[model samples]
Target: MSGAVQAGYAPPTGPDQPTSGRRWVRWLVAATVLWAVLLAVLTWFSIRDDPPTVREQRSLAEAGPVTDRAVGELLAAAGDGGAARLLPDVLRTGCRITPMEDGAALTRGVEVLLPGDDARGLLQRVADRLPASWRAGVETTGDGPVLRADAGEFVAVEGHATGADRVRFTAATGCRPVGDGYRPLAGGGGPETDQATALLRAWGGPAGQVDHVAAACPGGATARTARAESAPAADRPSLADALAAARGGAVGVRATPEVYAWRAAGTSVVAERVDDRIRVTVTTGCDA
Candidate 1:
């Protein structure tokens, strides 16, 4: 028989050759997939300047993956080392702080009270005054961050006769809530007292009728940038409009920019003009 009759038969490819080629292709695809996954993870977790303490964590979110130790550290960063003195709740339950992976956090918070004032002052001011035991449970998550203080909690201070109701007063400047139950925020050298005589008559003074004053001086915070203060207006503009425009969050009504008198949910916010500075006074109790 002739040995040259194999024209229709296809030559077999070497087993090693086919196997090596398949392996190389599979490896290439896997590498590509892994690279894509890594990129996505990095982008999601790219929160800059991780907050160092519980107080700092509050400035971020309220239901995320923050650790207690990290929250404490961020709060410390904002200068809340003595925050428990004012907040009071932290002493009992400590706080949690999670960093934001997305970049929207800077814009979502309460409006910065003044163009000159920003997050830094607000955090520092709030952090410093928080009662050592004042901090409440903290939470941070995909939505945002929240540091619950005992502002709304009825607590007896040394001087007040009636009592005090500290509230969640997130403001622009660093001054605290003062007056009947909030705080006395004085800018450009003003009186550090509340003018609610009716409430006072019903209540009393800080030592007598007053309860506890609330302020925010959260530590480890970067100060807000300063911008030119808005000119004073005889009739305060619509706070709803202003709030809609301002980038920061709930600035203390006592903030300096322009005394903006307005109302939110039936709450009266008074705006006062002092020389070139504008101060807004609000009966702050913003939990909403």
Candidate 2:
């Protein structure tokens, strides 16, 4: 009777007293789990839109060199022609990136003035000459035959006929961030300058404001092109006759009333009449 409590009396310490502590511990564990899950979700959202790698995040300025090299490769592939005009400005304007959630892209190109009307044949030749790694191939589209390939480093190359006498080749870089501003590299005229000058004098007279663009060739050499325009001389012979005479019976690559293309001393020379003025272009270091 001394140890036994009465019916209405009970001990203060019992199994139920420990339940509050356990409930507090459970609440703490749930709070920690929720916090961890929230942090993980936030981290995933922050990175979901980022580029997969740094290579894809290049800016226009950063990708300029790659684009220029690609241009060179295109020119080299089509170098058999008489003249090539680098379209750096077109690339700059076409690839100008605008701010967006998905970034932007870049592209560069060149125009080769080809003689003869066999545009498809010329494209085939260019495709065959492209680097084996490029996997160059020709596809006939509704417009015409097109040459498409990859220039490595995620750059793409394409060549298509723009006119009966012009074929354009372009290199493109896929989507990227709009990085720093782009400035074209300054290039000096090579020996081609003198060749262009001579052709200009033969075709017209003195040229005004000659422009030049240079590219790297396959053998660590530099390919240079010089362009100029001047008023046709009234006393000079016709472009075809003049170019024919200048060629010295070596056979002209192209001859027409408005345009003439020929090779002189390892350089390609092209003279074409634009309105009343004749434009002369000379290219060197891409003969091979």
Candidate 3:
């Protein structure tokens, strides 16, 4: 027997399980390809590359999104008929940069701007880029598209008619200046009107039972009080200067509540009658 024992060292046998190794490699590659395709499809849908979410945070009172809000703010800050014309633009079309118009901005694809962006060109752009749907107060037109998206805010006091012969409702709102603009005003006839309570009282009147309508304005007597009821619809600042003015009471200064009581019940619109008065309740806002 040899005094020194020989130590046996096995030679390197590359990949004893070559087949298994290859299969694993193949699976890994296949998985990678599948993942790539899946990723591509998901990416396409996720990033449409269209309008850039606007990032336009409007400073609203409490309401989420609306049109009249913008009109009210625009008008309030820009001084009547100022941002009123930008209703469709700020509310629907979105904002854009464009040329200059006589009074407003003529930007492209531009919907609205804070009081700061109220340059001639900017306002023109806003006024130009607007949705023709609810633009220009088409609801007032005798024959036109009457949308019923939360019609609760349209109820009115004084019988919910324009007069003894003509029936119609008033559009009121409340708003506050915040963020880069105003928040969408609360939706309603007027907080003071309590149209919802009035309407709920009218219950089912069998269409045509009443043939008159009026606003919560009450012949515009309580002008200030009435203003305290309805909220601004869509909030869009026309000129930054104007918004600043409003904030400083130079342009407009209005405060409103956090939640209009009538809105909490989930009753957008209600039909009712109280004593000799016929009224309709609607979700509304108070001008702060």
Candidate 4:
């Protein structure tokens, strides 16, 4: 007998394989295809379920920086009079832009006439359509939309209507209060009138004319405050300017808890620091 060693049944090392090996390869290939299919399904659903605002961000990002005119267009679209009767008697709209590190934040406010329950639904639709990035709970709020973004800062839109079905729509990039409360636009009844009435009453003064300092641009007796929205942050008005404005006339400066206030022409003008900017409020002794 020849002394020879015998080799066991060795598996094929190249592309060619035995029946059992081929079966194993087929199973692996099937498993991989299934995993890939499942992953694709998940991705599709995720994109499909994304909120409309997310898509808005993507589109706006591609379009570049937002402008005040762009913001006005949005507010005008949202304020379509046909959806609900805009209470011109009480309708008020305000737009302001605040400076930021990278760019500026533009905000617009519009007060409308709509029932509370109905307005919530309408504003929800508006919120869903907004391009501003929003907070988590904004999607589920009983009020309206509260949006925030790092590109500028927080932007909020809130709708409130009492049983009278009178709603105030306020949108802001900063923390300033919007439409302190609803008032009729007719009969000189509005934010400016109300502010003047409140301030004069607090000062225990008689009704008299009020005027803004010449240095205050976009100023009027009706506008309690004016912001230099067009200027850069560093170029904006400072606390000294506010103090100077309040002390321009026969008035004395006194530090109040919330502001530095003075009285002249039976009116009270107050100034205070809001973040890095200064806000000057001119309160006239107007009859409410």
Candidate 5:
């Protein structure tokens, strides 16, 4: 019989022909996936440390010197430190400081009574006192202009003058401004409390007369304002006399240099000289 060819039957040649196109495409896909995964891993590692950015570092650095200067100014104004004694009388009198001690922390704040209604001038004066490097600026808040030193040891010194001759100044030593002191949790006690009671007694303010007011203070401190009246001002002991008596009774007394004011525990007593009479205001939660 004669061999007849099939219509479309083709014999295979050697081994199967390689699928080059599909193989190349698979390899290319694998390589791309591998490269993407490698890139993602590298990116994650690069930022894993979470180091401070340039902006943050600059801010922190700028704040350090500014805060230090503010602290120095506060110390000088307070007149309690050895450095304060060296300062000129004019600079020292620009403000008065009251120091509060909490555990191992020692913090001081200032109270300024400016002469005129130049609230802006007062703010500018304080800003000028800082080193030129601080680049102090005044930002207007609801109350008044708040002097701010960005990235500093002392964050801000804020004050306001509603009118003329009624300026109130306060300084914030910490990174954040103190929001009317720590909120009082509840109750009150400690040797400080006892001292406060004794001081009030020395001032002739009956324990019954101590009225409580809502106050923001550490440990939920309750504010008390004790007023001694219905008697001649002369009959009442001056703030100095009361403080002396209190100190003699073994009460801790921290007095301003002028001797017209003193603080015991968290209580503050100020003797305001008006004409020939002196009015005494005994208040608790003073630094709170």
Candidate 6:
């Protein structure tokens, strides 16, 4: 009862202080925002520096040289006696890179005519001759024996028997965006061109268009191949007789009603009966 108004002491007051929980919440929000920003920056740098995928590394233009190199390697593995020729379809502009999708692809291939009854044995021999780094191996498939290997730099190589007398090997790039397209090697005809023309004339067929493909060989040399196919002629002469006459009566490595193949003077000649048309192909520079 101190009647003189003993004033109850009022506590000194300053700015309002937040509760510990509130302070913790504010700090946590700030830290979280900072971490998000840092993560975003790192992700941007990583994406900018690295390629998205393997297919993006080379466009169609760059793929040509890779394919050519693969073809050269395959031809070498086949040995000098194997009569080989570049596939005519490689010259076409609309060649597909993948069958599953619509995109441009690069393919360089050679068809080697080897006279043998055991097609699988031939593939095994070729596979064995390839570089060990290629990891070449032959496997039995439903169709026949197939050779598969990596040709380095993302090029896939595949080979299969076309028949008992022929084997087709192809180096291809999977589907890719067409950049600048492909440009075939340009050059004049060589001795192979003359042989092709002579064979066509002897077969009583019209002259065919000639195309060339070349690859850089070791020691700064270049191996060039010239190819020509005769137009379909119904009244053509017997393939064996015509081939014999054109090749100076030399017996063919493979002589059947469907195919006739021979090698002479560093060139390979093949005549295949395609849908009743004798498609003659002459290729040179196998040894080169």
The residue-by-residue lDDT of candidate 6 on 32-62, one tens digit each, is 9999999999989877896545764567777
23: Cα error in model 5, Å: 10
The TM-score, computed over Cα atoms with residue i paired to residue i, of candidate 3 is 0.22
Order the candidate numbers by TM-score, best to worst.
Answer: 6, 2, 5, 4, 3, 1
Model number with the top TM-score: 6
**Residue-level lDDT for 188 in candidate 6:** 48
| Total clashes for model 2 | 1
In lDDT terms, how accurate is model 4? 0.37
The local distance difference test score of model 3 is 0.27
| True lDDT of residue 86, candidate 1 | 18
lDDT of 6 at 205: 76
Candidate 6 C-alpha RMSD relative to the actual structure: 7.3
lDDT per model vs. reference: 0.31, 0.71, 0.27, 0.37, 0.42, 0.71
TM-score of each: 0.21, 0.71, 0.22, 0.27, 0.33, 0.74
Give one digit per residue, the lDDT tens place, for model 2 in 113-175.
Answer: 775777788788888987899899999999999999987656778889899878888888776
Kindly report which residue stretches of model 6 are placed more than 4 angstroms away from their true locations once superposed: 1-53, 89-103, 218-221, 249-251
- What lDDT score is found at residue 45 in candidate 4? 85
lDDT, candidate 4, 101-205, per-residue tens:
122222333333332336455555545555454321234345543432222323344444443333444443432223232221222333444454444333333
Give the Cα error of residue 4 in candidate 2, in Å: 36
Clashes of each: 105, 1, 73, 0, 10, 0
